[model samples]
Target: MADKSLSVYKYMCKYVVGTENHIKTIRLMNTFTDNLSSNNIKVTITSGSFGEGLQMVGSDLDIMLVDTTIDVHDEIKSIVFNPTQTNFALMTEDIKAGFAMLRFISSPNPAIRKICEKFKGSNYLSNALFKKSFLSELCPVLHGPCISDKSGHLDFAHCLHSKYWVTSASQWTMRSNNSWPNESTKQMIIKYGVLFVPIGSKGSNNEDLEWRMSFSVGEKFLIYTFSHTQLLVMHS
Candidate 1:
């Protein structure tokens, strides 16, 4: 069975692993990263799956953006990932009715702290709308599709069909006690880099505070080093 399975893998060996495709993928990766850097986002971009030899034929090109802006004020060491802040507009007239109804209490989620839950929802909504319009303008020019793929960041049209391409932009520091980055974590950073992505989970509104952190970077290294056979098993 294993032998036959390996035989079926022949096609993958042809299309997925090769010098030409690898060069093309790397070139595109560099292009995308360079463009992103032009926006003043000081991040060291790393291709997660390709160079690692874990890329599948129809998989979206995975990219990790490590922010190098913030540093750990440990009064000791220093390190970091790319956490960017966008200027969000103030809350709307509708969300203000909350604090009283308990539906819109004063919280950071709504982005309005201290006094009330000013346009928190609106702020989030605005960010999405802004990105949509921005991608439409920038992505196509680079031949990089920013199409939505629920599983990842963007989508790609492989020889077979569509593939969800996920790109994580994060803030990973080499030195700090931010619960995620620290001295011990620096080695891992050197291996895969850092990312400050959404740090939330699936649950209730109160429990779902979608905080951002650095985790996938570590996993990238693990999968990157996994044996080719193991990687093939994952695809299986």
Candidate 2:
């Protein structure tokens, strides 16, 4: 039994588990995909299980389309006026954790102004309306925060990029840990900031105005730091 277990582990490490070269190839493929898919307004990011170089069967290709034209900031003062991009302030007060309301600050883009609505004397972006606008003849199904094709092979999450990190995750940065995720990795995670998916907390009153915070970029970074043995263990 012990010999069989050892053989299985060795096989997994040699074949099933992805090596650093495999990860590099996956990253290169992702970069190529991104280059082909990305445009002036939005940047494409490959995500999910495959993004981590774990090629599991029957897994959908997860993609995040980050709107470069839109900018989200945690605080009003942190926002810098850009003549070309739409700006939104992330409002977290009284809202559920991992979710926030995007207050429409200013936008030179006419299309953005058309989707925004006034609520309680404040301009706010409607998550529903924003998502609705993305629906078309080809991709009509709304699967959670992602827009999926009829075949369900692909999931595209339309999201906004924020330059500033959220205040809610501040504790994570200060958390003491002897091993795993060094200070440099933490800084890199913070530097990338976060993405806002076009979804809200279920049963929340501000569902239409709220966007869920996504730490996928940082999560991917952490996954890349995993060793071959760690990957094999995770796969098992």
Candidate 3:
């Protein structure tokens, strides 16, 4: 019985669970594809289940386009003026957790300014306007934070890249947890920072101006650390 169970486990690991080398190869190929498809102003990242090196049957393709030209800062003082990049300060006060309002600070680009609306004498980036600009006849469906095709096979999330971590999720890095995700992993996640998806807090008055914070990059890293057994359990 023990021998049979061991053989079953080995079979599962090789076929269902996938070997370590197989997973690594998939990840490397995805990375190469992303690099080839990305540009200086925008970075294309393969996200969701496939990005984590797990490709299930009938899973849709998740793509994240991180706009590098825009910068999101936690505070106005922390923002260093860059002639080429547009800047926005994160407004988390009175907002729900995992969401923030982006107040337009400065922008060299007119196209960015065109999407912003002035509220109470301050220019604010409008989530509605931002998402609207991406809309057309081809991509009409809005799936939460992502824009999807008519078939829904592909999901593209246009995100603003931010170097600084949001204040609301800052506690996660310092939280007392001994078993999983060591200090090194935490530091690496922090260094990767965060991305702001063009979405809002539900039922909030400032929803139209709010953008939900995304930790997909960190999440991908964490998922990569999972053992074959753990991945098998999750897959199951």
Question: Candidate 2's residue-wise lDDT over 73-123, tens digit each?
Answer: 886774567878898988888999999888888888778867777878998
On lDDT, the candidate that comes out on top is 2
lDDT (tens digit, per residue) of candidate 1 on 1-236: 99987776765556555344454566476667646654443443444455354445666655443323222111111223223422111121222111001122122232323212224352132112212333443243212212334545443211000011112222333235665434554465454432333222334242122223344446655554555555555655
Rank list by lDDT = 2, 3, 1
List the candidates ranked by TM-score, beginning with the highest.
2, 3, 1
Rate residue 124 of model 3 by lDDT: 90
Cα lDDT of all candidates, in order?
0.35, 0.85, 0.84
lDDT per residue as tens, model 3, 1-236: 99998887777667565667777787898999999999998999999878888665678999999999998888677446787889888888887888888888888888888899887788899988898788778788888888899999989999997787777887887776684787788788899889999899888887888899899999988888888778877775
Cα lDDT for residue 55, model 1? 47
Q: Candidate 2: minimum summed lDDT over ten consecutive residues — where?
A: 11-20
Task: Give the poorly placed runs of model 2, Cα more than 4 Å off.
Answer: 10-20
Candidate achieving the largest TM-score:
2
User: Clashing residue pairs, candidate 2?
Assistant: none
Query: How far off is residue 83 in model 3, in Å?
Result: 2.1
